[model samples]
Target chain A: MLSKDFVGGLITILLGSLYLFFAFKQRVSALADTVGPAGMPKFLGILMLSLGVILCVQSVVHSLKTNAPALVEWQGEGKRFFRAFGLLCLAIVYLVLVSILGYVLAITVLLTLVALYLGAQFSGQLATIAIGGAAILWAIFVLLLDVPMPSGILL
Target chain B: MDTILTLLPDSLNFYLVLPAILGVAWGIIGGSLPGISPSITMALLLPFTYALEPSMAIVLLASTYVGAEYGGSIPAILIRTPGTNAAAASVLDGYEMNLQGKAGLALGISLYSGVIGSFVGLFFLVMLSQLLAELALAFTPPAYFALGILGLSVIVSLSDQSLVKGLIAAVLGLMIATIGTDPVSGISRFTFGVSGLLPGIQPILIMVGLFAMSELFKQASILEDLRVKTSPRIRFPEKKLRKRLILPQSIGALFGGFEGVMPGAGGTIASFMSYNEARRWSKSKDEFGKGSPEGIAAPETANNTVAGTSLIPLLSFGIPGSNSTAILLGGFLVHGLIPGPMLFARSGDVVTDLYAGLFFAAIALFFIGYAIMPVCIWLVNKPRPYLNAFILALIMSGIYSINNSLFDLSIMLVAGVIGYFMRVMKFPFLPTVLGLVLGFMIESNFRRSLLLSGDDLSIFMDDKISLMLLTFAVIFVFGSLAKRLIQVLRAGT
Candidate 1:
């Protein structure tokens, strides 16, 4: 039920407070000595805190002035939400695998997984998919131009 | 004359013959493929140009730019999907004509208008680039810093709906840029004691993730079957459509050229602005969304025209007119050619070749874009979803291959997530990229200028150029605020 503006303002205020804490620490130094390291940060901190306060105030004002749109309740039935989340997971997995399995192998597996998740019709043919995907990847990175992918033992 | 004559032999072989052909070919391929943009092609080609002669390298890059703009129309006319973001405006009427079995005619008109618009845009590029080249010689560090900041300010208008989010993203980008080591004092700001962060994130990989990977993530939701079965019906338009299209095309061309002249405004803005004007001024305003040919012609003409005009600021002053032009800056450095005031004095022949190449590229794109578009439609409209997956893999691999570093890949991933979030929030992603790209330049210049002035703030106001840049930045920010206020008032009423 929380408004995006409210959430955004809360985060800004939290970040601004952190900045202010840092700014205060820098304030103990002499003004001339402080100018180089802390001048911009201190100025930025005050500005950020002021902006955060303004945002918080604006969100409250907007809510009071107009009827807020009802937040859309998350429906548990959506495949899309899971699929997007899965993509982030896959990317992270791919990143970890890249060094061990080699870049080319890791990329191939990631692409196949993504394509399958997208419910691609071409997934019916397993070998064809791998060959086709690998060919395109090789052409772009290896043949057409020399991009140094981790060949490792796979080459 | 003697120097010109001596350089002529190498220029003829490398600049004229080789680069022009390569540029047109790349344009046709880039344009024909849906989602593969000219800017991407330019960025990809940038590394290869590093080993080539500066004059030839520049010519190739410039020609590719010109060709890609015109080439985007091929897919837009023959199929419903635009080949590039710039061609999105053309899809309304173009696909309508295609459905009506007039694909050939739509393509012909698109090619004709693109050629005409590009010529007009090039005239401005030539005239303005030369003038700015002279003015650029006087540029001070403060002026450059102001120019960079002003460039980022223009992003407020890029997505007017989420100006706050855009500014946040831009500021975030600047903050991120402050990582590694301070330019003035070599103190680490936010590198977390990592040596990799010392060099900072590379621009190419960031761009790849921001535009390409983020788009892939978003497209994951579209039904894969929807991409597989649509038959692209293309037909050439007849006399009636031509008559309606001509007036709007000419009208759009004028504004399009003007939009191109301004930094940060590119085809998307030009097309949107022209489309609105065309609707407001048209005799048959009711037929706009209903596949009016004028709708297609107006935006299409302006979009391509903006491409040629975008080069003006880039070549003349080293200020990028758009994101793609910013990417092309990599090419500038890679080829050992700097693109500021000294560019003209150092490499006049290269600049002239670029100018001439753009003109020729416009003509080549017209011929190639028209003739090969139908085939391109057939190729791009393949109903295979795995093909897209394959291409996506290739693109990602290409990005990885560039630096061969896992660090850059991680940066790309982070940027993609940020870009995706920014998109959902209606935050303009381009400005963030612009800010990240220009942040170091702005910061370094600001420091240098301050050092030069001995902490005198009057140095910024005293210089004519610096004052002009600061004034432009002020006007852009204020004007955006005023526009938002007006919109808010209208909504209230």
Candidate 2:
């Protein structure tokens, strides 16, 4: 398995490079001022690049010492990686549905899905908690607090 | 003093009192849980403050910060889980005291010590803040800029384990901070013409994601059920032990105050340092780790003491010395109040109200913590999965409530993912938030100072205060490096 640092370092390196590429492409002032709009980003980009390189070196040494291969380590952590990835995907889908289904209905569904994913029993308690919790939150936010909630066709 | 007294009564309307209770109560529950910190609890609740009157909102957040300090000690004494980072040192003796069947006495000591710490901390806070505010009145733009850099320099001491990774996180934050329109040139840098990007990332959004959502995501994988249950009781100390506590509590108060005033030295450091100092001054030195009242009292007092006094920097100079104060800064800004010396002149009444509110919070913490410690003990026995899910739902709802924008939700989700991964990779999250908070200030001031000087780099050097502040930054960064190099060199031999 690859050490965690190696993956982090690699991602940081790519991100730093991306920032620098865009920063250099940016249009600053017509007077070509120093420390202008591009200056902070550019400075940050270079700083990240150097730091990423150091992180990469340190992680590589750590990986060598620990005998962990880069690609295999990511593939090895199946349950953890998948749970996190699944949760993110679930959030995205729920968010997309929020405007259409309204927050209350959508959040109830989101809670149910989350409960199931977390391996909670499919009991009436689950239903009550999900629905009741959603309603209470809705009331607190939309009614009392006067925050406008997105309502869809069905609602 | 008279002004504060007069304002205090008016500030305690039901609108304020009710939220203060809720905030303190909720803060206790959140802080007693294993994974949640005081700042995270405050972050999760930050969005709700938008609907509140500024005074009520500020009081709610401030009081939560207060209540969480005592709450963090519950699990420390019970399960040996350092509920908050600052409570880590308390665990050694707290859990030991629990084992010795003095759980009630230990609980009492923590409560007493915490209240006493808050009392002393309040004294320091009220006295020092005015003086700091007076001093801040003299600062120019250059000095403010230098102060921002000085705040960032804290990452050196904060990230003792990995400076490189810390720098990377901070730089990323600074980069993200540059996403909105440039404050100086009135030109957009990285917004990509998106409407939401135009106003820049809201600190509230970043705070919510960085602290709450990210923590939720991290807990998703490692969630465990707590089967341990103990019905604990509380008993106030005897006269002798109470006398014993005075030495440690005083030590805690003194050390905690000194640490709180210095940027980067936060409650965790203060707690541990006070624990050691208390031991050094104690007659029963060997009892340090073995159910010593001084052990629990000292650290608990110290960490709680930090809750009030850490605001010295934040209230005085608008420079957040730690993560909690940084969140407090967000609360201040949300209410159209900028923290600094001008706050006294522009909003003296509000400042006085805050002092009054803090006093109330300190008192509220004692009663609330006293009532809830046993409830927390019972709650800890409940299913962890269920608790975690409920908390996650709270986080999502809170994020959505802000502006009701899908874009803000997306930012939160992305930030959560970023934060979760940052944790998985052992990266420090606080520095990133700090960098984001201070990045704009640092850049704008740097640019503005340069622009005024017609691009002369010597302007920063010529300004005495800026020079001294920057010099400290340079020294801290290099001094840390030198210390590390010497260690590496010595190890090689």
Q: Which candidate is the best by lDDT?
A: 2
lDDT digits (tens) for residues B79-146 of candidate 1 = 56677777888887777766776666676677767777777787777777777777756888888877
Q: Candidates' TM-scores?
A: 0.84, 0.93
lDDT of 1 at A134: 79
Tens digits of per-residue lDDT for model 2, B26-114 = 77887788888999989878888888888788878877887788788888888888779999988989999999888778888998898
Give candidate 1 regions above 4 Å deviation. Answer: A5-60, A73-82, A121-126, B1-88, B224-246, B275-292, B330-342, B345-350, B383-385
Error of 1 at A56 (Å): 4.9
DockQ, every prediction: 0.34, 0.61
Residue pairs with backbone overlap in model 2: A2-A69
Docking class of 1: acceptable
| Candidate 2: stretches off by over 4 Å | A29-33, A61-76, B1-19, B482-493
DockQ for candidate 1, C-alpha atoms = 0.34
Clashing pairs in 1: B101-B235, B102-B235, B102-B236, B103-B234, B103-B235, B103-B236, B105-B236, B105-B237
